[model samples]
Target: MITIERVSQVPEDFLVDNPEGGAFYRAYGRAGIPDFELGCFIVKRASRPVTTAPFFIMKLPLNTMMPPGFLKTLLGRIALRVAFVGHPSADVGRIQGEQSAEVLELINSELRKLAPLVSYKGFDGSLGLAKFNKVIGLPVPVLNLPPDYWNRLKHKVRTDLKRKLKASAGLRLLETDGLPKEHLQRVYELYRQTCDNADIQFEQLNVAYFRESAPLSKYVLYFEGDLLIGFHQLLCSKQIMYCKYIGMDYGKSRQYKLYFALMLQAINICIRDGIRQIDFGVTSYAFKRHVGSEMHQTFNYFQHRNAWVNALLKRLSFLLEPDESELR
Candidate 1:
């Protein structure tokens, strides 16, 4: 018989298979993000552990992709109490078990007890394992570069990248295994500012997470003369560089095209390290595409405990999809 249990936390050995996502669960755990109540689900088959997944309870906005107006604002304020099936602490949701379809459906049946809305996020779009309610996710962008990358790109592409780099010519670069303690507060402030200015909002990371997660991340720091202007966090695998998060002083971002310069810098870093691909994660569609990054499709599976609402969501799922242009 299969059984499921919900716990406030997991043992240290949970999800040990993917060590490459260093400090991920530690930094983005139960107490990591604001307004998130992380739920750890332990699924056992015949009393043997099969999967340990992180879920969350939060208020999810109903009005996405709507124009900025009274209708949007009114609907935005009206959120649903949602129970998410994957790790809600990060941009993508991951549930590790390597479970078969039958096991996944069993797990799903158990999780539906949590709230009106239950969704599994950050899975590859190709994995249509279950025929549950499906929402197409924002495309994940990545840059695949080879040796002599600059020379291989079209002439116009090279010229544009060069111009962007020239704006930040005076800035100095510092690459470190982790952020120094002395610079934590400033970097955290920049992170907050970036989140505040963003057009879409999700779970917000706290400074506590940044401080604790500092040691496991690879940082690319930007210094404008003596002043620090920006920094980006990366988690690297053998051949792929996951550009996870970034922080920047927006006051100087336009002055030096800081974000663009940072991407150029990341490209250089990837080339130097022989990292073949740069996974820029999601969002910032225009700039990502301009840099020759291709979008990889992902999906979120959801359902509502109420039969009527579940049917309603299926009908209105179109409102939750990414624009066709963003898919490019």
Candidate 2:
């Protein structure tokens, strides 16, 4: 028999045996967002711990991905209070240790008591539960750093990247363990711009998130003379470096190819620091792929407390995919 315990905070040593368990949620949750209430679920069988999965309570905007028009405008305001079995900002949904279909179902059952919309978001692996309204959320782009990583790309990609790198060579690169409050404020502004330009905005990470995440974050900041133009935030887990968030001056992007430059620089850092893989994130498939990022599929499995509402959600699930025409 399995039992689930929901709590606002996990025990300090809860992550000791299960290192991957509640850390991300705990780290990012410290500086909380208004609508997002992050929490943890402790699962046990016969008093022995099974695993710890992170969850959050929030009002999820159901029409977050719908195209801009009359219908999107109309339905966009319909936010549903949801209990999500995943982290608010992390790329992967980690239900660490012994996650079978039964475990997921039990957790789902427990979460539904909190809200009508209970979802399992951003899991790359199967939860093995067929009853949920399964949908393809977004595919993450990952670039692996193998030997001779730079030369392996297509000649034109390499040439264009090299030219862009050279043109932007005058820009100074500052690698910092953390950003000061002044820089953090500027970074937050750029982050808002990046999120605003995105087709689907899942979580609007607040400025407090930047301040709280600063200690754990490594920044690759770009400056042209004295002006800060672009900055990329990175978080390392074992040998994999996750390119978590980026803030850029888009007006200067066309001239400097800021995105491409940052990506190439990340590759250089990986080669230098012995990091194996760079998780580039879910959007910008074309650019990420142009630079040799492989597509890694991620999924979302959802269930509504009401049967009729569950069926309707499944039917309207096609709106979750990125609505990119040319795949930028």
Candidate 3:
């Protein structure tokens, strides 16, 4: 037997303790926006000493550009590929729960039934419980640096870094415990523009999000002669620095290279704090690869908890494979 429940139904303690669940909730909870479910999915097996997997929902739950039914079709496609999709490296810490073999089949079928409506690279149900018990396609560049080592970065990358440092000499990059009320709107505006330029619908954040996150995080922003041109946010785990959010003025891409410099700055901060690795987040950008960031596999897993659906997914796999495309 299998069981599913809304995220609210899950107890608070579990979400608090499980890092994966917490991250998922924070990212999709629209930064605490009201009326948005952000649609979290939890699965459990109803057998002896029943087991469960971490609560999961669509990775990019909001795609304003896509048609309303697109995600549903995508999710269905992912269900068909659950058995083959790899694990996500970005989500290192996951909530621990009982894994269900029976539920996998059920999920497969349900996904196929909804094929025309959702989209995903793979299903969290199938991939999460397998090798990593997590999604396996998030491309986070993890770096382990040696002591006093600015020597390891590629030469071109180093040269570019030098240029950025020289260009932004007048603008000081200081660690502020928090932003002033006046500066808050400016920062938020830049952030919103950055998201819009990329056609990404980021969860709208109020002043509280910035106020709360800035002090707790080691973030970097670039100001050119008193004008803020760039900003990036990062989270420091004991040995890992997770690159949370990034934004920069579009025109500065070539001249300033603020994004690349921001990453290097993060690395330098990591070295000072004794951080061993950096999780660059999901996408594989050119700069990430240029700096010798290793590509670790991550995956989405899914299982439809219905008998007929499972058989249908299996039968539809071949026909659906060509239609399958990555979420990014």
Question: Pick by TM-score: which candidate is best?
Answer: 2
lDDT for each residue of candidate 3 in 244-307, tens digit (9 for 90 to 100): 6777777764577666677778877878888777777654356666665676553433334454
Q: Poorest 10 consecutive residues of model 2 by lDDT?
A: 15-24
TM-score of 2: 0.92
lDDT of 1 by residue, 82-178 (tens): 7776665455667666566766776667667767777877776554455578888877788998888888888998899899989988889898888
Residue-wise lDDT of candidate 2 within 1-328, one digit each (tens)? 7898887865566444332334544657787776888788888999887977778888877677676778778888788888988777876786767788778788888898889988888886567866787777678888888868877878888898789788678789998887777698889888888788876777888888888778777889998887888889987755778788888888886688888788778888888888888888777788788888888888888888999998988888876555554236
Clashes of each: 0, 0, 48
Question: Each model's C-alpha lDDT?
Answer: 0.76, 0.78, 0.50
Report lDDT (Cα) of residue 291, candidate 2. Answer: 80
Ranking by TM-score: 2, 1, 3
Regions of candidate 1 where Cα sits further than 4 Å from its true position: 9-22, 64-67, 126-131, 323-328
TM-score for candidate 1, residues paired by index: 0.90
| CA RMSD (A), model 2 | 2.4
